[model samples]
Target: MASDSSADVVIVGTGVVGCLVAERALDAGLSVLMLEAGPRVDRWRIVENYRNLPPSMRLFHWDAPYPPKPWAPHLETRVAKESEQYLQLEGPNARAYLQGYVRYAGGATWHWAGICWRLTPEDMRLKSLYGVGRDWPFGHDVLEPYYTAAEYAIGVCGPSDPALQWPPNAERSKPYPMGPIPFGPGETRLTEAAARIGMMNLPAPQARNSGVSYHGRPPCCGNNNCFPVCPIAAKYDAATALPKIEAKGGKILANAVVYRVETGEKNAVEAVHYFDPNKVSHRVTAKLFVIACNGIETPKLLLLSKDDRNSNGVANSSDQVGRNMMDQPKLFAEVELAEPLWTGVGPVQSSSILNTTQGEFRNRYAGAMFRMENFARSPLGSAAALKKGLVGKALDTEIRRLSACTARLTVEHEPLPLPINRLTLSSKTDWLGINKPNIYYDVSDYVRRSAKEYTVPRLQQLASELGATSFQLSPEFLNSDHIMGGCIMGSEAATAVVDADCRAHDHQNLFLPGGGAMPSGTASNSTLTMAALALKAADAITAQLKHG
Candidate 1:
């Protein structure tokens, strides 16, 4: 093994959370090193990859554009038959646990819809308020400042009117960085239709620019390709923040798959061992280390790094390194409306009916957020038309009809952390001969009960109210990609992997930020919360360094 260098801090993963932590640490005048397991990729390259995809792959373009590197294999949900290659899923809800995350330099943010929703105050104290799940160590009021900081860093565009804002009651220290992106015709119509049912459809706060540029990126032009790849750099991705980190004196080592973390006296992480694409191992040492490799990979890395001192795993003294897995179980309904709603004029997901996200019913069932999916349906319609054997004008007409009339409404339900739904090391190995991540997941009775009793029935009623001639709810739950809860945070070291500040209780110098430390999964995209937690952890790390 070669020992090249060391830094003040070493961070794994180059996702939004990792990049944010790097930027903050570099700003504090600390030399930082980031290790990304996958190869560095450009935005235009991803766009080109999407464009080059065959018609059959276009429907699943999110997974098509970003192919996994050999050294850093991510889950591929497109090929159902090959699901066991990277993630060996088990249990009743294992099918729904097939996550869609990329291991590239930018991580999963490259293809995220950019929805930036904050956790409500109630969302923080789930166990206290509703008698289910675990509460965050701190409340929303504590994380509000960090939430604001994260929003400004990512250049969020949200509604100026408090009514349209997410968790409209959230205490705001400042308004959104930019005004809301105007709703497209589909969203406007859906909003109006929802109003008729006494439900409110509010503009979604997104990480894309709205009007004037804030962070050198141009405003959104509404090409409606927020997924797969945004042709323009209007949407915020970790790749955008990465260059800023490098500019601020941070080094990023791509294709460095960190496999082992070494601990020294007092259980402080001394160094991490990583292998390059050619399988050349290198040891990189640092004063402080952070594992920001999302929910799944972070725990997998911890479990993989079994040392003589910590045989179970690094930071597994609590035996909670890879326990308490959670995600927002999602279901959608495909409906053919009586009139043309024209669903594809702006960003893919601009608005959602969010009132159902919280309520008194949570004690009995799970909470859910509902949204009208805004992805352009032309590709799906065209594929369906072709499969029906339509030709020429018939095909074109069918495609247009389906594109204009069809709409999909999705319901994402919050799932409490379940220890049974855990991530363990699989016997299957990847290209580097490291064990793959095996997850045993079950959504449990909370999600299943909510889907049957509340979400599905409400969706059926809404579809009927929208004048749907053919409406079919999906029978199986799907993964929302809002992965959370593995290295969960708590007050006690015996039950949690990390503390409130995201510091690993077992390893004083190690920090595990992002979704892995989240105690609960709210009914929203978790990137914003993950980023906020990263910023919070950065502050804690800075304090520790100063004191030491």
Candidate 2:
């Protein structure tokens, strides 16, 4: 058995956020430990994990049978197979369309279509201006510096001109750590058509590498597969940062699944008790505990840690830990261009049409476009979802067969919170003895109506301007697996689980960092935001530790 370790700070998950937290916290001279539930991931050896799986299943397939295909749902299910079917948050969702998901050491970063967009000033002020959503106590201006820092650290590449008329939020401090990926021929045709119609379109920023090196990491050769694990280190994965933290005297215990966070009578967390791979129970004590277990796991962990001391959950004083489940509603529609456009070659998520002008779903402050390349309808993924989602084959054979030649663009829109969608404990347990994530989501009438009524027509118009044969939201679509806000941040306990600093409200020394604390997801993906927030939290912790 490995020797138990301790530290002044213990970060529960070694995902990107946790790593950034450790990096910043370590620089501030704090002794830290990162606890990971999976094994130490060697990028080269692990790239094989991406191989041989069906293209449809590649992104979701991790650790072999452990995840099944695509990815397993974190939701509850009395029967395992039935649970997998219900867990898809996308693609033919039995109900709400929030389908695709995957889990790995790097967390979901392993297979994301790399987009790093900042939330708009409007996104933060959801309540004041919109009067429908909650307001972010914090705003983009506050995190802009960190956003720049993370962009460089994670090796982002793009041509941004916040001043540019199209594809809003394109501006950044330095040229990307990696230079921008030029628009492919297929996207270029669509761009011209968009220009013809006065709709803005531009190359979207991507997290994949365009160069041979950045901060000692290799560049992306346009690996078609961003899912599974990047065989080459072209894309940034949190595992890349893990070793640096470990090298700095940080102890990382693997395959140790944490079950409960034991707290003192005063409500400060004392230790996290977990089960090892061998089923041995162990405990790690720390001055502070940080939870970076993604959105679903973070809340589930907090709620599951209940004992005699706290019944509702460790930090359930607010009773809002597992509420406000948010998923970005995606609108994937593109015109079949009159000419052949080689759309399948470059990295996924290549470009986006910037939307700065106010509209129904977006106001001046809402997020901007997060465009990309390979919204390619694979052989199976295409033929099935006719139009946007499929009911039959006539649409599939005609529209999907030519996917190899079509130009693709997607609008990654933010969705409001679904109160009922959450991570609750399941009545059943996996063979590993850990309870799987159980979810219950009810899509709003507003979302269904808006997507069908508004977003779809816009995408169709885009395709038409480009001389597209057709365009429509897929017959099947769902919420993105990029889950956020299960445990939101706010000042009032009635509304949040953690505060702006990502600290647990009920436990002074415990911090919950990651997408779980995000009040709202920006235009791009959450990895960039989570990383920046982790830095801020680490700074706060270091300041307090220094004061004492």
Candidate 3:
């Protein structure tokens, strides 16, 4: 029962990147097998877990994300254990990094907040444009086709605005698979103010489907809890396409947590070792190996697999498997609008004030675009925002009002990279016995300066224009939950983890297809980039298999 299973390609982890790569491999005529660390999620059975709370209580802290069912406990354990490894904050008052991703068959996408923002062309071309970070070997133009393929695969919905794309971002070939989310209360007020102030209120791009069938997937029921678990198939999770893979002679086995990649005589990956649900050891072998675990797990898995051949880690001969962590700073401020803002609606607000459109994110000096998170607030966020943004007695009174008419400004922006801020393996181990991932990230001088000199003033002005009674700015740099890099992509083996195509530089067959490939995605949701990157990797592997 613990014998090795063979396939043309053995993909580790069944998250977004793994699932898409498996699909591409299957379509390319390769025998693929997806090895997962969690069990399969059943739609009909899982629906019973949703109590469906009232909209007001939506964002308050619940029972620590404990699943209502048996499977929920399993997921909780995995996430909690992993969170400890990657969720450490560098300073006090820094937002607790939210690394609460699940390991179930769908991985974290099943419970992901359905926001989808593309890393602008400038994000990929930071070095060439801003003269800051290293230049990506492949620019947005190179990944354009793959972006289209991946968007189609996931059923994305949004309005296409090629003109909206900042330099260094890939241009859109087609419109969003579905229409954009309608404007909500906060957005309406913000939009009105932005127009008055000569700013554009750009529509937010999302992974949620507005039509009946987006790439053959169902539309959302507006359940509102797009994070943690989505009952209906309205959202585009990578596991959305698992059925087709199974039908195409592909097999996905779960609870097989891959801790390390085993190498053969010639340093070719011989097998992958994982623990079953029963905690029994099992090994699976393949002609080639693909590493698609998310940012943290991907690098941790690599460090754990290090042998005498690599003192650093597997595919880490370049000593860059876990470096260059570049997640954006979460900018926040809240304002008590003098007028009613009316925010009560289903996933109503996700657009932003297009400061970049008026040349805010660009000055031929330093920049990255960011939008206000109007509809993305949780109860905790609202309470905290009120307390911080509002002063003393006014804070208590404003928070208690809970009026639909209110305004809060939260922005996620690209941050500068400091080599010290990275993911390294520590001597500590989790309950699972794998070495814990050590995340050492502090806000760079670039971001701190930008927040003070650039972001804060604009936010204060925007709020004032929106007729705010008061406004407050955060003193500390905030981190959006988007985790990326540590295992970055580049052409040089000595500098990065994988090449432009996302294949491991040291290993011919190993590939990393997720945010880990992105050295600097600025302040955008990484899901779309993850999809686009996977498609690019899939194409390269197909060419290799067919030729050699």
Candidate 4:
């Protein structure tokens, strides 16, 4: 066993949320330490890994570039059997929760599309507005300042014009750090086509640098490789914060898999126990502990930390620690257009139709956010052409035609935080003898009804407007990887795992922020919301530390 280390604040994950909290804590002059289960690697190493991948794996294998460590295993999406070794899924929509995320130092921000969507005021008051899902304890007004702070911290770029803003009446405290990136030929065509159908294709707020650099990172060069790995640091990722965090006197321990969160008097977290790759045990004590490991891992850790005092697991007094699992259950549509839209000129995702996300229809079913994927179709086109056994000029022509004429449209439906959708500790163990994350996910009739009644028709309309020769909508719901609600937040401690400040109800010194604490997901990427919540929690943590 190694000797115990100590700090003012200890964070269990080095992802964006953890990094955000660490930065703020460090800024507040609190000594911070971040423990990451995964190994620390340079951005260039990940870039090389992406470049060396087979063309077939390049598109969908977003986590392929960052191989998971044996001790800190994550899903290996390319191989189903291998992936099952980590996350165990069941239920009618188990496949829908087959989350694709990297267990590297930076976390999923390494492979995200960088879209920063703020939940509308109505989204926060789900129960009040539509009487479907749980409402947030606080409104969007309370989170607005944190949203702006998060956007600034992550170097978000978006249109200054309020008309182009998502939820245009959001009442932003500040403008975007940088201007919005102009749409590519494909996005431009789609925007025009969507406008004709009474839809607004507004510029999405993204973390990538648009023109001039805001932070130390360079402007986006349009590598069209935002996923898997951004070759250049044009886009924001948590790995970029590691150096800055260290520069600010914060310590980061990589390849340190934290398994148990030890609690003491009054059920406050006293220390956290971790294991090295060699199975050696180590302990670290802190004034406060923040578990910012994504939605799945955070709840999994809490459930794994069962003790004599807390038999149901730490922070599970309400028995809601690993319940209410949620994500934006997605429906994809592949469209073959009449013209050469020619996507892949800018970031992988730059704009979306957020108008669909807000509507009176939420009383019956979920609302959704729709977007035309900006990922280049060349690789998929080439694979399809090759399967036909075409040769020479014929093969080249077919590949070009398919690549230029096809586009993928996706609709992500809002999910209700149902207690039935839950995450439990599986009997199966990983390399380090820790129980794997077992999830029972059902996209529920809320999303399914939205797809069948609302979103599908809208998708067909857009495809028709784009002059589609052929259109194919996915038969099943897919995972957006925007995991949320495992440690759901609310005012009452009896029903929720965490409070509005993301502070665990069972423990005063413990905070669990990010996606896990979010009560509702408004049909968009949850990263920005996660980041905003992290910032909000950071403020609360700072106040608690300073006062107590």
TM-score of every model versus the real structure:
0.98, 0.86, 0.86, 0.98
Q: Compare candidates 1 and 4 on lDDT and give the better one.
A: 4
Angstrom error of the Cα, residue 416, model 3: value is 2.9
Ordered by TM-score, highest first, the candidates read 4, 1, 3, 2
Model 4 lDDT tens row, 71-91: 999988777677677889999
In candidate 1, list every pair of residues with a backbone clash: none
Instruction: Answer with 1 or 4, whichever has the higher TM-score.
Output: 4
lDDT of each: 0.89, 0.66, 0.68, 0.91
Winner on lDDT between 2 and 4 is 4
Clashes of 2: 38
Best by lDDT: 4
TM-score of 3: 0.86
The per-candidate count of clashes, in order, stands at: 0, 38, 13, 0
Worst 10 residues of 1 by lDDT: 1-10
Cα lDDT tens digits for candidate 1, 104-192: 99899998999999989999998999999999888888999999999999999998887777787787888999999999888888888
Query: Which tens-of-lDDT digit does each residue in 399-472 have in candidate 2?
Result: 64466546555665566665666667776566455665566665455455555665566666666666677665
Model 3: per-residue lDDT, tens digit, 115-137? 66665565677777667767788
Clashes of 4: 0
Winner by TM-score: 4
- Reference-based TM-score, model 2: 0.86
